[model samples]
Target chain A: MHESASTQTNPSPRVQRAPQQPKTADAYVVTPAIDVYEGAEELRVFVDLPGVAADGLDLDLDKEVLTLTANRAARGRDRAVTYKRRFALPREVAAENVSAKLEDGVLLLTLPKRAALRPRSIKVTSG
Target chain B: MWSLLHNDTMKLFDAFERQFQDSLAVRRADTAISFLDNGDELVISADVPGMKQSEIEIMIEGEFVTLRAERKPGAFEGFKLSRAERGAQKLVRQIELPCRIDAEAVRAELKDGVLTVHLPKAEGAKPRRIPVKASA
Candidate 1:
């Protein structure tokens, strides 16, 4: 099906840089795509960063800001590319307890809500 | 009878052609836009991932609106880079409004990688009420 006229009218203002020519020694940075899912008590981030190893990834959380940085090497080759992405955490999170893991070039991060931010179910007694 | 079948086949092919074009359109790297209609105000949201606020520009002329931004190259050079992705890139897009917009009343904000532009409809474009008096 064809997209509506309104959809066609709205275009992305972000520009894409052209790929550079290969050289004897070249360094390139690749940014991974991200997917975010929100739960009742936590927010999960899934980043697609191919060719990156588990040890090369880093996750930093400062207050409500979350930064994801990784150094990825192309598969089966000496040349490598680096990827970096930052996310603004919707709510305050426990920076100390946040954890990350890399599996098959995808990095998954789980940000847990701070103890005080978690909603509490109050008990009510009938009079 | 044969002619009727041929017409149906042509229609099917046309539909397929349109679908292919749509898929190609969405294949573009940057792809998210949102519009909000509040009773008297309108908000348009554009996604500009990896772009700094300083690099973005918005212009309005008559009933047309345009957005532009530039993306700079990353620091990594040499060492035989394999794959490089993500970074700022140049982009420009424009839209024509169906009705006149009040340019002076426009407001825009960039936050969390999203750009939102608020435009208020012109006084004449907004609905109005006229009082009626009893006949003499």
Candidate 2:
């Protein structure tokens, strides 16, 4: 069943990510590209971070912000590189239930909406 | 000796030539690659995230190594894109090595999102250490 018309009141939802800023100036840091998708039940995020191992990845979440950091190991003369980015959490997101997975150097984050924010159906009765 | 000086000059010219070719390759492919000339092997690494092993193609001919890969767009069912910075891309890079390598001994591995290739130096191209002997 396709019920997308009534699912989102706003056809286009604006993402509220904060402006990108390097945490430190002394290190070699880069910003990885990311893609965000929105569904009726949850929000999905995909981040490209090639060469970053699972052990070098870190995700931090609080009431307002979500921070992602990853470090790639040095190869020969190339020095170690760091990727850092931050995002502001949406109001309807269920922070406690958020899940993250990393595969083939891509990170996928699933943020489910709060129960109250989900759509509800009303039954009609004859007068 | 004059021969030794001529060899040094030729080596310098070769280095410059390789650098120019590498720069052109980078411009054409828009991809950054790292080439490390180890004592016995050359290690080449490139960032190719969101690509499957089967999607990458490697070709080696003469002294050049070529890499080709493509990244497909991430489209999900029943979902709409709110933001998209990582999109579909196709990359083709042809890099020349500083020395001859044994084509049969080449090894490649993909880990995390990085593709690494190890090219072993050819037997005739490797530097050999010689011992000096004194006789009475």
Candidate 3:
């Protein structure tokens, strides 16, 4: 061994990779294709997200905030793209029973209306 | 004097072209999307306000869904476009999914200018429980 291999690498002369830049455009945000419907006791929402998978999707509910995040693998020769959307809950939602499904290229998020938010039927007694 | 007239005409044409391009861009920005979820099913709604059912096409491949609609130029024939702020615009939206869904159960309907798509969860994807039994 003429000299230690570790000494041959010079810190000053070594080339460093550039830091990745953060997205700063509105187009980069995952603008979901959405649909809203009113049912007997709750409101249903459907969000369309293409190229995102179940493992790559994240749904979080904090207080009255509902957040949806999704990541897709790189395709063809194109770079990877990330999509995120946040919706302000109209009222308190049942966080425990919230369910989601992804099929084809659509993301379905089912939010059951809180018991208090649902309309109640009153029984009137004949007087 | 003739050169002056030619320059004025060129300027007018340029202004018309710029206005046309701006309107086209505005139409593209008018696309709106919404997501609704009930415990049983997920509904996706989009605002293709001026689109006809026949003109809209929805396709799903793998985990990607594409929505394409075109408003024919003369769809509103003979109707004066007075103060019309909506319609006359083509809409296209592509969305990605977050989980595997039951493609076979997917259904779509359009009414009152809103497109609603129902996506049900697959049997294997839904939450289930395994019950424990007593051993002898």
Candidate 4:
């Protein structure tokens, strides 16, 4: 998923977020391209959702499943469509620790690893 | 002294050449787009995933219009990637507006990952309203 990240021009913007998820409606759905990276502390999932406004975006985490939806209103000369993607997280994620930001056309999600999941460096003690 | 200046010029030239290559990579890559003519205006829709509004460049010269944006790559040094698809690449696309347009009156917006541009026909080129009169 991340292979193309190197090949694509990234204009990722500084994010200002809408913490409140909006009321979602049924609309045309298109699957946005996504890149997922696993870090020591968190998982970074980047999704391309061009045309979706902050108010139209929604994120829901149910147990190990993550579903994101964002609607794009038809601007002055185009037709409206909805973007949706679902991921069943392989590892557990701390729901409270998750943070999301919509920048440029990409949705960047940081899902912090659960307490037990984070890799810890053990200190070497001379016995 | 002359060698120092020459080195500086060479460095600048190399930088410019890299920038040029980057733009060409984007231009040659296939990013999906649609162009529609609505009689009075030309509507363009492009999907520029992972790009910000400020990163986009829309240039119009005569009948040609160009779209450019980049999808920057994040640090992947030690992280393991689970799936492989899509790309983090510079995107460039171009299209002709059919007829000359009122460049100053053009409007564009980026929403979701889509860029839309509306270019209206030049004033003189717009079809004039004609009224039919009855002869008594």
Better of 1 and 3 by lDDT: 1
* Candidate that beats the other on TM-score, 2 or 4, i.e. the better one: 2
- Which stretches in model 3 have alpha-carbon errors above 4 Å? A1-29, B1-136
- The best candidate by DockQ is 2
lDDT of 3 by residue, B46-124 (tens): 6554456788898888887788876553333322222123335576787786556788899998643456788886666
lDDT digits (tens) for residues B1-136 of candidate 1: 6335334433553354344332222222245465665647667766565456788899999988888876564332311111223334566888786676799989998654456788898877765678999999
Model 2 pairs whose backbones collide: A51-B113
DockQ for model 1 equals: 0.02
Ordered from best to worst DockQ, the candidate numbers read: 2, 4, 1, 3
Count of residue pairs whose backbone atoms collide, per candidate: 16, 1, 31, 30
lDDT of 1 by residue, A24-115 (tens): 13545444555544444555565655445567676767665555666644322234555555555443456667788765445667777677
Task: Give the range of the ten consecutive residues with the poorest summed lDDT in model 3 chain B.
Answer: B75-84
lDDT of 2 by residue, A1-127 (tens): 2346654765643332233423334446666677778776887988887878888888989774677888876678877777777666666678889889998888998988787866557699999
Best by lDDT: 2
Position A59, candidate 3: lDDT: 84
TM-score comparison, 2 vs 3, better candidate: 2
- Candidate 4: tens digits of C-alpha lDDT, residues B33-126: 8788777888887877666778889999998999888766766775655433456678677787678899999999876567788999897777
Please tell me which model should have the higher DockQ, number 1 or number 4: 4
Give the CA lDDT, 0 to 100, for residue A120 in model 3: 64
Cα-based TM-score, every candidate: 0.40, 0.75, 0.40, 0.69
Q: Please provide, for model 4 over A61-127, each residue's C-alpha lDDT reduced to its tens digit, 9 standing for 90 to 100.
A: 8775567877777654445666666665544467767899987667888877676856677899998
- Rank the models by TM-score, top first: 2, 4, 1, 3
